[model samples]
Target chain A: AQSVAQPEDQVNVAEGNPLTVKCTYSVSGNPYLFWYVQYPNRGLQFLLKYITGDNLVKGSYGFEAEFNKSQTSFHLKKPSALVSDSALYFCAVRDMAGTGRRALTFGSGTRLQVQP
Target chain B: GAGVSQTPSNKVTEKGKYVELRCDPISGHTALYWYRQSLGQGPEFLIYFQGTGAADDSGLPNDRFFAVRPEGSVSTLKIQRTERGDSAVYLCASSPDPAPNEQFFGPGTRLTVL
Candidate 1:
């Protein structure tokens, strides 16, 4: 089984400032991590995923995440936040070896508030 | 490319009524999944279909929920005797035939039970 945890319920950041959304995971095997963003009345949009690559993975809308093996964390980060970027963010994970098993487990979600 | 499409963007019905939500996966995609999203929560997996068969339904709350993916393209989720707790947005997503691929999501059908 695999599970994800978004430690913060909400994160506030000023426009043009850097921001970070924390995410941690627990899985029976090696983890495949993903990040998704949801706008109001919209579906979850794929941001990025960490399968087998570098620790810092860049994604759409200038977002990136660091996959830390030791800490078991895959935190989303941005150099300069945008007010339009305010939305709900989710972190998900699946086991690498759960081939026939479901490959996605999402966190509770973290609300990102970018103020001007 | 056309993303996944779902029908009945919004549905409202009284308790004990039955509802069906539809989904059309991206063209040629072989993996379809159904997920339910409650208020202030992330989407929870309901079922997964590989081709025309249901490969997983572990997340389904009970026997009242059923889904089908005949012909391996379009899928429908049927809920019977709906309760107030069944009200939520149902999302459908599809990916390629293999694992570790990104899943495209539909706009989702908001089912509200009164």
Candidate 2:
């Protein structure tokens, strides 16, 4: 079964400091990973996805994630954290080799808190 | 241009009652999905629809949960004999055809079973 694990329940960072929200995935075949953000009382908004490409993939709102094949990790990162960037982050994985199932398996989620 | 939209943003019902949640996918999106998200948990897939047909329904918890997309645009999820455990936020998402695309999500409908 394809699954994602977000080890940290919460991550705290100061504004202008680099932030990292960790994510690890387990899948049978190639993994299609995605990062989504959700604000309070709002739906999820897509940040980026790592289908197959370079290890580093940049996404919206100055966010990026590095796909480490050996580590089986895809950690979301930001060069400089902003207070407004604080939100709930979710890591999801999909097994490309799976049959007819396109739904993504999501992680428990990590709460990012950027202090001003 | 509008994103996916769901009706009855908040619904409070008594246990054993029937409730229907509606979802209107993005214009021209061919794939629609229904997911249930409990408090402090990620959304869990319930069903998937390609056009007017249900391509996958394995994630549905029980037979009491039913969904239909009669016109391939708007979908409805009907829960019969709702239990207290059924209280959660029901989310609907949509994506373009051809599979493996970023799904656009709606501001889920919060169902509260008393």
Candidate 3:
């Protein structure tokens, strides 16, 4: 079984400041990680994914996430926060080696509040 | 191209009633998935369909929760005897293929069972 944990329920950051939403995962084998953002009444939009590449992966909307093997973490980062960045963020993980289960396990979610 | 779409954006139903939710995936997508999102929580996988066959349905909570993707394009999720606890946003997503591809999600159908 695989699971994702986002410790912070909500993160508040000021505009123009850097922001980080933390995520950690546990899986039997290697993991494929992902980050998604959901605006009000909108479906989740793919931000980025970490399959098997550079630890630092860049994504849409100037967002990025670092895959730390030792710590089992994939924390989303942004160089500077904007008010428009306020939304609900989700972290998900899929086991590379599994019983042919393609389902992704997701974290509870983190609400990012970028205040002006 | 249009993204994954789900019909009946909102649904209010009485407990014990049957309800159906629909989904239309991207034009060329061959993989479809169903997930449920509770308030304040992230989406949880319910089922996965590869083409017209259900590749995985382990996430389904119970037998009452059923889904079908006939002809491998449009999908429908059927719930029998819907319970209050079943009230949640039924989300549908799709991808070109199963592995490594990121699933594109729909706006979701918010089901409210009273």
Candidate 4:
């Protein structure tokens, strides 16, 4: 089975400061990882995905994530945080070789709070 | 270029009742998925349909939960004997064929069971 772990329930950062939300995974084979953001009462919006190739993947809203194979982690990052970035974030994973199992497994979630 | 859409944004029902949630995937998307999001938790996979067939229903919790996509564009998730524990947000997503790198999700249907 594949799974994602988000250790922090909440992350706080001041405006213009850098921010990071950690995520790790456990899967049998290669993994397809993705990050999504959810605004209040809104559906999850795709942020980015790491299918293969580049280790550092850029996403919407000036967000990026690093895929560390050695660490089995994909941590979401932003150079400078904005108050509008405050929202719920989720990390999801899917086994590349898991036939017929295309559904993604998501982490519990991390709440990002950016203060002005 | 409309995104995925789900019907009945909110539904409230009593325990032991039956309910169905609908999902209209993005036009031309061959893959559709259903997930449940509990309060304070991320969305959990329930099922996945490729074309007109259910490629995966492994994530479904029990027999009471079922889903189907008849024409391959629209899907519906049916829950039988709904329990209070079933109350949560039902999220639908769709992706293009070949691979599902990024899924477009709908606003989700919030179900409240009393």
- Over 4 Å off in model 3, which ranges? A98-100
| Candidate 4 Cα outliers beyond 4 Å, as residue runs | A98-100
lDDT of 4 by residue, B1-114 (tens): 899999999999999999999999999999999999999999999998999999888889999999999999999999999999999999999999749569999999999999
C-alpha displacement of B32 in model 3, angstroms? Answer: 0.4
lDDT score for candidate 1 against the true structure: 0.93
Interface CA RMSD of each prediction in angstroms: 1.1, 0.9, 0.7, 1.0
Question: What does candidate 1's lDDT look like per residue over A1-116, in tens digits?
Answer: 67889999999999999999999999888888999999998889999999997999999999999999999999999999999999999999878885535647889999999999
Lowest summed lDDT across 10 adjacent residues in model 4 chain B is found at B95-104
Give model 3's TM-score for chain A to 2 decimal places: 0.97
lDDT of 4 by residue, A45-106 (tens): 99999999999999999999999999999999999999999999999998899473688899
Supply candidate 4's per-residue lDDT for B48. 88
Candidate 1's DockQ: 0.77
How well is each residue in A52-116 modelled by candidate 2, as lDDT tens digits? 87999999999999999999999999999999999999999888885736888889899999999
Provide the overall lDDT of each model, using Cα atoms, as 2-decimal numbers: 0.93, 0.94, 0.95, 0.95
Q: Tell me how each candidate scores on DockQ against the true complex.
A: 0.77, 0.80, 0.91, 0.85
Model 2 scores a TM of 0.98
- The better-scoring model by lDDT among 2 and 3 is 3
Q: Is the docking of candidate 3 incorrect, acceptable, medium or high quality?
A: high
Query: What fnat does each of the candidate structures reach?
Result: 0.68, 0.68, 0.93, 0.90
Superposed model 2: Cα runs more than 4 Å off: A98-100
If the candidates were sorted by their DockQ against the true structure, best first, what order would they fall in? 3, 4, 2, 1
Candidate 2: deviation at residue A67, Å?
0.7
Q: Candidate 1 residues B10-105, lDDT tens each?
A: 999999999999999999999999999999888899999999999998989999999999899999999999999999999999999758888889
